[model samples]
Target chain A: MPKPMLKRSVQQTQTNNVLSVTGNQKQNNQNQQMNKMKIDKLLRQKRSKEYMDALHKLDVGGHVHNQNKVDEITNAIKREFPEVEISGILLGYVSICYLGKPYEVHTLDIASGIIEHYKSGETLPNGMEKARGIALHGGYEFIEVYVDCCRAVSSNGTVSVISI
Target chain B: MSDRVISQANLSYIERNLSAIHGEIQALENDVDAVNNNVKVVYDQVGVLANEFHEFVYEQKKANRLGQAEIKLVQIRQELEKKYGHYDIVRRTTTGILQADDLGIVKKTTISNATEELMISTPNYWLAPCLVALSAWISDQPELAEKALREGIKRNDEKTSLFFAIICMRANRKSACLKWAQRYLANQDEENLDRKAIIVIDAYANGLMGADTEGVISREMTKWLEELAEKPGFVEQQTTQWTEAINLKREPIENSGYTYLPKYSNTWPVLEDILEGANLHANILAYLMDIFEQESSSAPIKAQLDKILTSLVTDFDDEELPLRKKEKFEQFVVEFCGDEDRARQSMAIEETAFETHKDFTQLLTDAAMKPESSHASVATQKFAIALSKEWILNAYNDVIAQNRMKIPTEIEINVDTFNSKTTDGQNEAQLVNEFTQLVTKEKEAALAKNVLTGFDKFLLIGGAIIAVLGVGMIFGNPLGGFIAVIAGIGMVIKHFNKKKQLVINEENIKKNYEQKLENGLQIIRAILAEVVDFRIEFAEKDDESAKVVDFLEQITPDQYVKNLSTSNRRIKM
Candidate 1:
């Protein structure tokens, strides 16, 4: 399930610039659409590193420490992509719930650095389905990050998202 | 009439409205049809696109450029990230490459290096990089691979732990393999790589220990390897299909590359791992021992391995197997490398055959008893004969395989010989004698009984006449007396006939018993002939010809052939 988001708030920054909060909610109370975040090079690099660290941590099987570690990672991700919802940390990877569906981003494509997700009703390539089952049953966690834009980010990395 | 006069205008208005409504309905129908046609066109286009894309994918695969295709997919993933902000993309290019790796393609250092770079470069994508590191180690670049593995471990990556254990296994770094394997077992999910880690630890520990005191540990390790080879690895997804298809036409792909041998202990473990569990065979143990001896040249390792395999190498005679089951148990152990269950099954079958043979021997002894003319005795003889024939036929292959007895080519039973035994155990002379005996006995008994019965009938008739005469005198009626006398004569004749038939039935019973006894003897003789023939055929090939005949000769008329407990009676008759 998608995490409950903070009510959309428009605040005047110290610089008098307007900032709005957007997250997993379907619509703002004012019925306004959430705008996609813009990805600049430096931001991508920073987010990419954080995502890598998160994945590294997940790989090392350390996700089950406590809510604090999860919150820390969740906050870091929320900072980068405010619209991405963190439902909970399951198995060591953050579960990014979308539209009431949770996708596990278990491994990265070394070439593209994109985290993999398996949605319900989607056919996995042959043995991967079984492997996914094993990984899930083995307490493997997944991290799936999707912004309104085509790009997705984890604390350690940024990747372009596509449906295969 | 006046009210109806204004209604014409109203009618005109209603008609106009109805016409307009009909036109609107027509328009709606047309619009619906157009929409349906447009949907159809879109579906057709999608189908074409999907087919074209599938074809393109197939072509790329055929050209073996799946690596490049994966790279392209990764680029698309990156493109999505650029447009959408950093996002998670599934079924990514890495999955396909990993499958290719399982097919022995991903082990190319260049490919693993590329994957490693992508993984290291990607933000927060740490889980898959450990796999890339594994590929590197597989490709013979251990240093960088170990570094990546360490990083994953630092990140608390469970996959990295498994990879490290596997890496340790490949290097023959036994202690490290044990450490990482135990850690992985403790922390790894039961569903994931748990079985794999267990298999590795079991094999390594057992293998490294060589042979424990009983050699049981090594055998267990071999069995574990056999079972492990049957399990499908993660990347085995596509290759499994490819291998199945390929196997239909040619040899199967050796493995899914999960347990490919690594650099350090590549020779023994790699060879051992890829044996498809052939290590579990007795010959394999012997072969290994032989090669080990040749390779080590009196090294301490030789002493250890020798101790380990000595029990395995011991002959069946030296082992604890029963003497009766030694032959079959030996063959089974030698073939299966002392697989206890199969050996036991084999021994069980041998035991059953031996028991059957013993039962047939006892039956023969019973059949040889004098006065074996009873119905039950005859049935026993028939049963024994049939069982002996079946036993010989069934045991032919087993005996030959075990080298217990050999039948020369000329010894095979011809159709005429088989028919001679199968038709009737009795010779023509026995049949004639049986028929003659039944005829003679029936004729003699029938003549004597007929004479006596006839005489008694006459005497009864005379006595009835006298009594009827007296009845006439007392009643003073001749008609009544005449009728009474006729009835008395008919009753007397019927009783005499029944007595004569009883005498004939007794004679028939006597004839049947004699015939049965004769037939039973013939059957026993035929079965004994077969046994004697088999012995003769076997004796011709025996170095100790006299021993074979001597065992057969000891089977006296009163004793069962099996009861002759001579050492030379190895060939069961």
Candidate 2:
């Protein structure tokens, strides 16, 4: 009697399990996958944030070392390409090659900013170095060594530069 | 009277002459008054006579004399009518023989009889006899045709031959047309070809004369070419002609094509030469294509034949030139109410059309270029171009040589410090990569030169050496050792400061190198782009010579006949 009762109990448990598994299983499975995807995305974001924070620390140290370099580039731009600080790259080649001079001193400074056009093609040589060039890109351009940098300006003021 | 005169001459010369002159003056005055009175008396008598003369002269007799004068004027008008009136009959009959369904000689005697009557009335008119013969031939009266044709030839053989050529062509009598054309060409010298010969040639070249199956007409034209081409400096003359013609097709090149080359390169002149030379190929092809692509002239045969016959009748023969001139002057005088000056001015305005002669080669070019002005059809233009293809080929080859000579082997890229050249522009990526490596080496050299290196290491080593020496000195001489220690300390401080300066210098160099590398790379790449365009355009245009050759190669007589399929359907009766 005890053996039969145990088997009967096991059968009842199996049937209940089958009904529960079939009923609402599709809905429950979708909910489980969605929750798992959300958890995984959050973990990835947390990892990426930690990684970026580490990278930012490294970049900060690099900036501290190159602080003088940035200042030096700014002074060079003031000396060679004075207006490039305010004007955009449309006037770059013309400013460098102005006055029919094929070669000119190229000192450049670039900071992230929206591009604005310099309509006047006017340029003045200010304490320009002789016989050397610092390649200018985006806003300042004057340097030419043995290679050419091809560039295109989109309508929305984005300058796409490709070095060949 | 002699004695009285002698007595007056014998008196004092001056006084005697004066007195005699006064007496003569009085006598002349008296005579004038006497004549005035006599004029009055005669006027009164004439008035009386005028009244009686109407009674004496009969009205019927006056009318009879006036009628006789007008009758003589009518005869003069009939003579004038020969030029304007009777020629219409002959021309209409001749044109009708081709267009009218019936030779109509037996059924419709009206026009043929009128043309026959013109031969008798206008005996000296060359076309009159020719038209009579053409009519008789249409009537199948072979005997009558022969006699009148003999008369027509004797009068003006050239006109007779041209007349029959056009007539036979219009009649669709292929053999007779060729024979007549050969007869006309036989009498022609190249220098003195008649305008009518040009018309005949236009017809022949247009293939309006149907399929010249025997090629006899082509042989005749070839003979004319052989003779003309054999002349001194003929080839040279043709070369000059074609050179001018081809040179006209060349257009001025605009500066907008090459954006950078003009600014940076001195190689612009050579580049311009090649570019313009290439442009000529497109221009020449487009010019020919514009003509060839036009719808083939689909003028019906009757209209085309009518235009030819109209050219024949409208043009006067040399023998009838005086009569035609007289007729024109007479007509003008009548039109302008006998105003001789106005008549002469009017005649001068139309005088240029009187030139009924043309040089053969000049005619060919004129017909090709100004087809309408030279009275040429579209087919004639095509034929003229086909005929002169050899000359065009010669000139085109010369054009190719001259321009190809100027193509640069290498293009120079000049922009400030970036001065280099490229022979091959297609491998832009490889060329760019190579340029970058070269610049890197150059930048390294510059950095070595501009920025001091190894000085920091030297300073550090020197500072340690001085410190060790000071320690050793401290044992021997305390004061000296103390001073040495202080100096070493100062040296070590200076080394730190020097190392800082070195970092700044290095930063400056790196920035300069990076910027220069970027710009230089861009410059070389941009210049290579222009070179690519130049090389591609030159080769593309230069290769057009083959197309021209192919164009010329396909223009055979057999092919020309094939092209005539459309006209062939409409040409034959």
lDDT of each model, Cα atoms only?
A: 0.39, 0.59
Question: Which ten contiguous residues of candidate 2 chain B have the minimum total lDDT?
Answer: B564-573
Model 1 chain A — which ten-residue stretch has the worst lDDT? Answer: A33-42
Residue B327 local lDDT, model 2: 59
Q: What share of the true interface contacts does each candidate keep?
A: 0.00, 0.00
Q: What lDDT tens digits, residue by residue, belong to model 1 across residues B1-573?
A: 766877987889999999999999999999999999999999999999999999877655544443443454455445544642211221143444444654554437666766666664554544445656656656777887777677767665554555555445434454565566555555633233322333333233223312233434233333433443344331122223222322222222354232211211113232222222221222322322332233211122223322322211221212124432443455554444435466678778865632322121232222322113311122223322232222222222112112221111111211211212211222446434544555456556655554445556565666577556747654676676666666666656666666677778767766665565565445435443443443343334322322322332332211111111111111110
lDDT by residue (tens digit), candidate 2, A58-127 = 2122212354544443344344433233233222221132212333222222432111112122232322
Clashes of each: 46, 15
**DockQ scores for all predicted structures:** 0.01, 0.00
In candidate 2, what are the lDDT values of residues B74-178, reduced to their tens digit? Answer: 665576565556655665655565456333334435546867778886767778888778667766788988899999889888778877876676566767877
Report the error of model 1 at residue A54, Å.
Answer: 68
Give every prediction's interface RMSD: 29.3, 28.0
Native-interface RMSD of candidate 2: 28.0
